[model samples]
Target chain A: MPEGYLRQSPLASLGLAARAATAADAAGVTMGERERVMLVNLRGDGVDRGFLDRVRQALEVDLPAEPNTAAEGTRHRVLWLGPNEWLVVAGEGEQLAAALDAALAGLHVSVTDISDARAVIALSGAQARDVLAKGCPLDLHPRSFGPMRCAQSRLAKVAVLIDQRDDAPSYDLYVLRSQARYLWRWLDDAAREYAVRIIRP
Target chain B: MLLITCPFCGPRDESEFACGGEAHIVRPADPAALTDAQWADYLFMRKNVKGVHFERWMHSHGCRRWFNAARDTVTHQFLAFYKMGEQAPDIAPVSYTARPAPRTDPALPADPALHTDREGAR
Candidate 1:
């Protein structure tokens, strides 16, 4: 095997970027283009302390120390997914997987780039929670999950990470890429109660 | 409802956790030297004690971390919770301890996402 080959994740081929949009629309209205981001799975026989440190050094971002909490920057954000897992999101066109893999190779960890493994759905509107309430049981009220708050919970039968960020009741739902169409249909059906326009990115 | 005391998150509904069965079972030093029956016993058998017992539970829906809990099997009451690698509290032993009857139906709500098999499924 080539010396640097193993250090690169295959998902690096897909560029990742953060998509931001305005939510000036009405109730249940969907504004802003949906953007896709990479979701990487990090695992090892044990916690790799040095690997985490190296990742912070390379990315110039602090890893989220609390579960369900997210750390964001101008171009990237890292969410604490689990004890040995994290979700790294960056702007589209960025080779994040390979960059992260190469940055933490000596730490005895396995990084599987999941850019294509998951789907990203961004919802912003007054009725965002109203739509989510149809499937999710968690309290989506702004007081419970305001900006920077995240939780790994169910969106109907599908597992998802729900991040509530915008004051306009906007939310970002993430699930396996294979379930994209299913979730989209569910969302569309749920949003029908209110006026919603699907914006393409 | 079964209210589990998370070592880190305080008391949370049992729905947030996954039971890891009985804890404190040490592995044999040389597994290769054991007989088939011995290996099978170690791998598949458990006491499933009815009284106070130590068990492992993962806060799958909360911190997404594993910890230990001292629970009364009969009452389904958690006596204490401890993080992984931490020692269980030292409780005095009582000779007259009685096994509490298992609660036939617990009121805890289910957390569907914690049981899903997807990546970052917690």
Candidate 2:
């Protein structure tokens, strides 16, 4: 309980800064940690217009109703986890959950701040898809999984939620906090063949 | 690997799914009134059929939603995928009765040479 305590990511002990500095400049894959992103689990009646409208008003973007899709607002990215379940990734802490709670005051919905439950690792570069293809069974072809698409699937045998951030084919792998180190190591080793640059956030 | 089509997430590898045994087993309203045998029958009895089987499957790795599927046990072919609480689709069941009939021929001895009476052997 120190007065000036610092928040550390699960992969903090990996010394990513030291590694990134010495990484080959011509690497095929660049990996980094998005340690400050906040996550919130939102579940409500997807069929209810009122519920949907309230959520849209709160987030300033429509929650993706289609499976495996994501909608990005100015501050949040809403990923559809199921028919009525979504995971909101926000750049700020706790405020998104508060906004959702205020918007859905009397509705039959659940909004939980799950920011500490998972860790997000950013992966992108020319050979990123090939590195993911080594273990994941999902069709990662751009035609199938373009930007703004997200999916919950296994990556290197670890359950992860993959969000394709852009046409650079960048992805954010959301892994359980307990398995973040293991998944990071797996990705590190998997990306070695393609030359990985471990970027620090 | 079998490609299972989740009603919500579409086709995914079988590894991403977990099979929840036989579907549509209703729970009794009053369990206390039922006899022990009746209770056990309701709890343990499962129709492990060989033909068109309706089962519950969860898209564990994908959407993590439970859905129903009609699959042929003999052929490992999925007949249909419907959402949970929905009735099984009415499709002409796959050919499950294609098992070859037992070898029967009048020309063959009633008991093949392999079956020898113990007394005859003595």
Candidate 3:
């Protein structure tokens, strides 16, 4: 197999300088981005066994069927957006899209690369939910929305897709590319109460 | 600040949902046979119920699905939120303040007594 394409991510300005810091170290919330993750929009007949099987073979992940739920595989993560639509998260977006296209050649499905369309910001720490609740209306309580759950809600004035990733009360906010800076600033202001820290991812 | 329950995404703030005016206004099957006045009625007329009403709403910020809803125009209480393909729930147009749970099946009951010409989105 050939090496993957050297596509430019929107956050390329940051240049991927590796660093790590925790909520404890930051005194409260640790805010950062997932950095260059691939986003693929997948739409198909979820009830069709053939389509589901081919999707699994292409991405090595089972398509999540439950509303606001996510399914993970070794190589990919899929979040259920609608009854028949999903957002596929991967590392190599173009390659994955091509592979899915080839694998399900005759299937009635749509696999489009939306990696450039969104920027995934990771907001984690003990008080992350509290920070999110400042403007978001979704029940971000641990008992209501916990790990493996994904929701689409508006943050500030823009629509975003958020999913609870790791259980440090960690959540990933996927906003449109144009709104990334505004949301970043919004989160910064929101997290000010908890003393949030930003680290390169 | 009404909390509308999106059938797919559970209850969400009314801010996240956009009302699509009246619902269940079926287009006449034989449009060519209707007169201009009848066509105007079909296109522009809508029942303005003060108590309970059938409407369409879109969870634009959430799952982005468009579903039907039963709401009281006067009280702004959402009585029922159902999927697009589903039938409108049965309601007796009780006072806006208090209404029992809507019953779903074939069709909702008609209540001409609830007429008032209430205005606003949905």
Candidate 4:
């Protein structure tokens, strides 16, 4: 209630966003026609060596070998979110989470669907970096961070993945869906200094 | 900023992960059996190797797990990342490789109740 918090029913909001974007735009946002991504949460006491290999083979993307890193191909992107967990971004209908679970079926691991647990927002256009610079600390210089580069940092108070795409000066940000309205409002306010446009996809 | 590859979370911003220390140090199994000199060695000593060396890291903000990393002490380039129990993967032969695996053993007994505290700053 502090400032920008859009409090609409989840189902209603979902319908609105879906209606605005075509299927292709939704895919770019990792949401299907339904405007949702199948998020999977994985947990284990320690690193599961065999499971990691299987994930690599299943997603066909190299697991980032460094912290605060991400890797992407034409179809999918795998983000190192924590020591015991990761976030896999795929097309809206892609069964990345299920495939990962199947790959680690017998291993000592726990996987849960978190597709709805977080809110994802894709911010493109030239001013995206300027908007993010308000809260994030990472150097956004193209030379320092380019395609396939990502970082887990805070956007105001929310934990977010700031993934830079191939498009110059555009970025995709993921956070808790519950916090979407707050983040959107914050971003909109931040973008006031520059010419900004907001679209559902 | 330093780019750290968390064994669990993949590569993330250094801000999200915490650096533990040199990865290969083992704790003394029996504190009572060792001479004071040996106990001191276990407590305060570290090679702090230059160039490519193994170190311990935790994904404190995300998955909250600890893993091993091979990083160049000089360039601060991360060479390889592996989970907690497995040995750090062999560095690519072309660039820089770690010396033969140092005698890595659990220096301390596993604490059944010990869990990583995830609230601290990375």
For lDDT, the strongest prediction is 2
- For each of the candidates, give the backbone clash count: 8, 0, 0, 26
Reference interface contacts recovered per candidate: 0.24, 0.84, 0.80, 0.44
lDDT of 4 at B24: 74
Kindly report which residue stretches of model 3 are placed more than 4 angstroms away from their true locations once superposed. A1-24, B95-122
Residue range A5-25, candidate 3, lDDT tens digits: 665545556443343443336
TM-score of chain B of each: 0.71, 0.76, 0.74, 0.69
The DockQ values of the predictions, listed in order, are 0.20, 0.68, 0.61, 0.21
The CAPRI category of model 3 is medium
> Where does candidate 4 stray beyond 4 Å?
A1-34, A42-49, B1-122
Writing each residue's lDDT as its tens digit, candidate 3 over B1-122 gives: 88999888898888888889999888999999999999999999988887788999999998888999998887788888899989777888675555757776456545434543343323
Which candidate achieves the best TM-score against the true structure?
2
**Compared with the true structure, what per-residue lDDT tens digits does model 2 show for residues A1-201?**
112246677888888867774635888999999977889999999999999998888888999988999998988889999999999998844478888898899999999988877999999999999999998989899989989899999988889999998987799999998999999998889999998888865
Q: For residues B1-122, what per-residue lDDT tens digits would candidate 2 score against the true structure?
A: 99999989888888899999999899999999999999999999999777789999999999999999998888798998999888778867556557768899989887755566755787
Output the number of the DockQ-best candidate: 2
Candidate 3 clashing pairs, residues 3+ apart or interchain: none
Which is better, 2 or 3, measured by TM-score?
Answer: 2
Runs in model 2 deviating more than 4 A are A1-6, A22-24, B92-122
